[model samples]
Target: MNTQPLDDAGGPTAGELGEHAVIEAIVAAAPSSSNGDDAAVLTHAAPNSQVVATTDMLVEGRHFRRDWSTPEEVGKKAIVQNFADIEAMGARAVAALLAVSVPAETPVSFFERLAAGIESRVAEYSAELVGGDVVSGDQLVISVTAIGSLGGNLPSLRLDRARVGQRVVAHGKIGWSAAGMALLERFGRENVPEDLTEVVAAHCAPYLTPGRGVVARATGATSMTDSSDGLVVDLTTIAARSGVSVDLFAEAIAPGPELVRAGEVLGVDPWQWVLTGGEDHTLVATTANDVPSGFREIGRVGKQSGDPAVTVDGAAPHYHGGWVSF
Candidate 1:
């Protein structure tokens, strides 16, 4: 990989580098022993263990904007989202495959930075970037397939496993990404408040504690999901699938001080982001046993009554919005 500075303006383009050189750069940026073959050959799973896999895609302009985020941040966000799905299933990520599509004129430096970003995040989770593909297209497109291991004797955490009387628990922030996105959209990146820069970073590349899903599973989590589509929407999915209804506590899940300050600046209710905003990748689970360490009790599951599958303070939420891929 080129170590010198090469901004988009005067850098060598993918078209100029040719496919072979571009792929070699990417592999050099993120090398793995599992690479160099036609396909990645993963190790055998542990005794009585199962393999878990999930895929997610990000398209330039639709999922992200170059003006708002760096190529590195885009790579990290793409990897994080896919790995979060793996963890949500009560598994530990073991390997990942990345596929990228970009215009022929795209800068080679962009991919180098992107590969570094993906490799860094994958390393943080102790997962391997086994193999991937690069292709030419009109716009940048990134797709990741994360492979995980549900270690011996543990059942895969499924959305429909929640039962009536289980306590709903959550780990990690719920609305920081949305708040950051709001800050960026309303104030632009350069003008964001100093105190709110962290929020902006969260929107760019959300982070979650790795292996929390296994912790939740060991702690008797019955159902689990990541807050990729907002708290209410995800819980609603759990409820509908599990034949139960969820009633969240307002105070338990309310926005914190930073969010409150952001709300004041934006004149938008912070609770709206807490309930309706998405992509924080927070872990939410239902457990009949004690709430696991690093997790807080936020709500409880009940027999499905009708109409609203999820509610806060036993009432329907005023903010019904959440990310809809459509």
Candidate 2:
């Protein structure tokens, strides 16, 4: 997987420079004071607004594979996950702190590309990378803590806010990530069909719009979350938290041709992917009135009879929920 060995004069290995030098190189272009400070000091644009922060980690061989994703892709995904978390609270992404653990033999170019990826993605929302730390480990591990602003007056959209009789809406694509993972697992990186290229890309690094979560709040969305986990699982979180049940109308969610084609290739039901597959970063929300533009209705919130439940087309989904750590 080495594009060129770090031993080459053009690219140095991490061990060649040692930890302090490696860290200086990694944080050289960072926008935040975290590079030199013992701790980063932050102040919000709207001092009256509430602050929202979230952290996420990606470990090699667990969350991703070097063969399937480039260092930049992994870095971008690490930022996106934390950004999505802030957005889930109906807030604007503001800043990030990164931490990494990599093997001594890793190439220095990998750090350069990874830092570039984080900077590029966060720059979409005018966010900053305030600070981070680097250390040695058996494999690559990335941790990101993203901070966001609610901007004074807007109420945060949370998992516990969905009400019975509200419409459950979605604002991004779904199932493609799962389909992409399936293709990668079955075909590896060789001889992939042209039709599956998009699906494969989704699994590698699903697209995420920076400010969609704030838009959901402005649209009067009662509750919101990104589909980091399976649709049913994340929806179930809202349902349980709000003491409501959610019934998804499968007919309302029309899987695209790409997803259906991937399913056909895998001999599995595409709806299962829609119902249980995750990591699409799709925005799912509930609102009493009509959803805003770019949003679509797929389900409804209802009073929980006894236990909070999530169902598809009035029945339980056959597939298991996604990305179980255990």
* Shift in Å, residue 320, candidate 1: 1.4
CA lDDT, every prediction? 0.88, 0.81
Candidate 1's C-alpha runs over 4 A off are 1-9
Q: Judging by TM-score against the true structure, name the best candidate.
A: 1
1-326: candidate 2 lDDT, tens digit per residue? 23332223447778787777667666764555544688877763687888789998888778877667766677788888889889888899989988989788877777777787788888887888888888988888889999898975768988999999999998778888888888877877454588788788778777777788888888789899999888989999999899999988877775789988988898889887887887888889999988766778999998895543987777776665676887
Candidate 1's C-alpha lDDT?
Answer: 0.88
TM-score of decoy 1: 0.95
Model 2 clash number: 0
Give each model a TM-score: 0.95, 0.92
Candidate 2 worst ten-residue window by lDDT: 1-10
- lDDT of model 2 at position 125: 75
The numbered model that scores best in lDDT is 1
